[model samples]
Target: MADTTADGVERRLPTDEARELLALVRDIAHREIAPHAAEEEAAGRFPRALFALLSRSGLLGLPYDPEYGGGGQPYEVYLQVLEELAAARLTVGLGVSVHTLSCHALAGFGTEEQRAAHLPAMLGGGLLGAYCLSEPSAGSDAAALRTRAVREADGGWVIDGTKAWITHGGIADFCTVMARTGGPGARGVTAFLVPGDAPGLSAAPPERKMGMKGSPTAQLHFDGVRVGGDRLLGAEGQGFAIALDALDSGRLGIAACAVGLAQAALDAAVSYARERRQFGRPIGDFQGLRFLLADMATAVEAGRALYLEAARLRDEGRAFGRCAAMAKLFCTDAVMRVTTDAVQVLGGYGYTADFPVERYLREAKMLQIVEGTNQIQRVVIARHLVGPESR
Candidate 1:
């Protein structure tokens, strides 16, 4: 809404059509989804109705080629949609992000035939998809995953082992499963598209999480789950590379979500600071509180700038992985800081569920952990800066 784009950077806003669509989506999210977020979150019930609305609106397929029933929107535009959705409810926002991540493997690696066969179902309906990468023994060290997929005589692969911390595990209609197919380690892993109804494919009960209670997380057990050869994504031994690439884009989405969450918290804080009286004046007028607002607002702007830079690099097909990781690390940390400070601004009210700042704090914590922890993000950034052979 302002000329806030960084210097020497092209301030590219969304096209007219995209702006209109975004407005519509934001309106729907605020009017329809935001109102029920607290109730559904407190009840720990998934927002099926919200997702049905999103799917019908063709948001599930944004950023994909329109020929496949996708919105054919740019990643930059699609990410803003995610941000708006997240401001209404983190559960729906993160769920959509994970679903988009799950679709990444197929869209990026699947053959034409595979795209024709699977993209429609994934993009057209309310069916959700899970990304199976983290195992119980391996979270950040993805190379240590134990799930295996052995080739059968009929050219199908029999997958066996358990995948842990799988989002949408119990509810997804399909999953992009990463399993060890050759030997132990990252170089031996392979990706597969597993149907939810496949025999021997089942999920444990949803995990009890500290936040994001509405989205299901669980352990997915693959016991002799037979998947056809065509289900294999990309080449064998390429899973790690594909996974890493997907994460680069995924991290950008997380950064955008964090920005949105922080914005919501900041807006809430500002509104409260202005109305809540203290010392015969609104707290916002006090220099101390005003400086806090300044810092929060500044962090939001910086986070927004970093994520947008990463998106521009990605859109240009440049090496954006390092930048993406940087954005993820900085933005998530900004969110944690800003959201916590927001609660501070609200004083005791922030501590209670009476305000949304408390929920923002919980949601911010998960952003640091998922899509590779903030620690891993630093490592990614450092590695990019200092080559393997460098000191």
Candidate 2:
């Protein structure tokens, strides 16, 4: 059974250990993350040291196999930990999520020898990772990706392509990349584990964004980057399948981050409303503002519940792609609404950098676009409900 807090939110953690883990995450967030979030973000500094701390604390590999130095926690527990981190800083939360996504291909489909050789170092050895699936022309239609990997006479592969919108692109130690190996379309693709410093691999400058500037997003170019056959993650022509499978879980991670962001915005608004004087009393005492707070709180709770439901399904080894899409679509939409309302609650202060709501609003917009756009999510859900559309 889970526990209920004074804030009226019920955490449905399955074990006491999970509860303790959440408490530890909160302690870290309050002590180490929150205090530096605004400053680091404003300065556009990536907190590599903070990621090292998380890795040392066994947080960077929370949901993988314990044999590989992972914590072996379920997705439910892992995601709640993400929520706590995201509440402190979205850069940290989303960075962790992307790192985990980068590990999915090898962890799930690699040969035993490959897993034994790479999983431990990748999972908990202080090495960060990036996922390379989206390209300049293949954001929504991922099947149309044009990156090519040609096999060499020596059983090596030489890859050539550009991957765009890659989180942690320049800083990651490794990348799980997908590229064309055969014909056109998804069936031609294959997955590989590429070292970030491999010759011919380089990152373009990071994109200047509205928020989360502390996290780098850039385009990665594979200019004839070569890797041995041993680096192939799964069977040929299976890269698209592997990529979609990873995104199903990655969407849940994004959903958890969105809920955390919304919760943070709500907390900021409520705290300000309770102390800020309006006319003669606290602004929170007014029914109009109070109702707004109520709605924001409700949305946060609802989004959390939705993601947890999808996570539980994932942990049960059930098919959860549609649920994951729904959670991502709804939670991100909720964050945009809640953050905007939080700005309204703070009036002019929210619009300024003095308050974090403005930044929250900016960050919330990216969640709706990443993993998959909300429109793409709707198409996925509709396909699940009624079969694929006619060609």
Candidate 3:
């Protein structure tokens, strides 16, 4: 509503359209998403209808081309939209990110015919998507995944393996799955677009999560799941490259979510301090609390700026992987620290479900782990700067 981010920091949108889009996102977040977030998360309920609403609203395809039903927004604008959604509820924000990641392989590498046939539906037809890369044995080391996809007599592929920690594992309409197609290691990996209802495909019960309970994180079992040649995304050995490239952008999305979460926590702490009383005066009068809020505000602003910078690099068609990794690392880690302080600022109430700060506190840990862990992010940055270590 104000010409500012979720926090009070002024935002400089690229155009009037981008500003209006942000305002729309803000309005939807406040009225539709934030109100039900606490209740649904406590109940571990996924908001499927809301996702459909987002799809219809064109929020799901913000960064893609408008020719195929997308909004054609730049990465900078898209990342800010994610920030607003995340500030209201991490499940919705991160869900949209994962969906965008799922679309990357095909949108970036598929043939014109393939894009014509599928991209429009994926972008706006309310078809929720999941990304399957992680496995039981492979988490940070994604290149070590063992899911297999063997070409069959009909020229279709049979996918057989389990994908662990999949968001929207059970309910997605489509999935972008990376599986082994040749020899061992990353070179053997291939990306395939699989229909959710493919034969023998099944999902394990959702993992009981620390936070983001409203988002289904489960192991998806692709037991002889079959798809036509049309499903193959990119070349046979190009899947790993595609996956990594997608992560470079997805990491920025995660960074934006982290900043939003941190901003929400800071807002809660600031509000609590102002209204909360002690020693016959408002707690805001205390210098001890004042400095803590200042630090939290600073961290939120810094994280937001870092992620937006990376998004701008991506939008400019520049090499942004190093910056993306840095943003992911700093923003996720900063949210963890800032949210912890927010909980402390609320004293006893912060630890309880009575306050959203505790929820934000729990959600912060997941960001450090998802979309390549913060540890892996540092490795990415180091490798970008110093090259990989000798084997």
lDDT against true structure, model 2: 0.95
**C-alpha TM-scores of all predictions:** 0.96, 0.99, 0.98
Q: Count clashes in each candidate, considering only residues at least 3 apart in sequence or on different chains.
A: 0, 0, 0
**Highest lDDT scorer:** 2
lDDT value for candidate 1? Answer: 0.88
What order do you get sorting by TM-score, best first?
Answer: 2, 3, 1
Candidate 1 on 304-323: residue-level lDDT in tens?
88998898888788899999
Clashes of 3: 0
Worst 10 residues of 2 by lDDT: 1-10
Comparison by lDDT, 1 against 2, better one: 2
* Per-residue lDDT of candidate 2, residues 1-391 (tens digit): 7766445578999899888888888888999999999999999999999999999888999999998888999999999999989999999999999999999999999999999999899888999999999999999999999999999999999999999999998999999999999999889999999999999999999999988899999999999999999999999999999999999999999999999999999989999999999799999999999999999999999999999999999999998999999999999999999999999999999999999999999999999999999999999999999999999
Model 2 stretches astray by more than 4 angstroms: 4-8
Ranked by lDDT, the better of candidates 2 and 3 is 2
Instruction: Please identify which of the two predictions, 1 or 3, would achieve the higher lDDT against the true structure.
Output: 3
Cα-based lDDT at residue 121, candidate 1 = 77
lDDT of 3 by residue, 1-391 (tens): 2367555579878998999999999999999999999999999999999999999999999999898888999999999999999999999999999999999988899999888999999999999999999999999999999999999998899999999999999999999999999898899999999988888899999999889999999999988888999999999988999999899999999999999899899999999998999999999899999999989988988998899899889989999999999999999999999999999999999999999999999999999999999889989999998999789
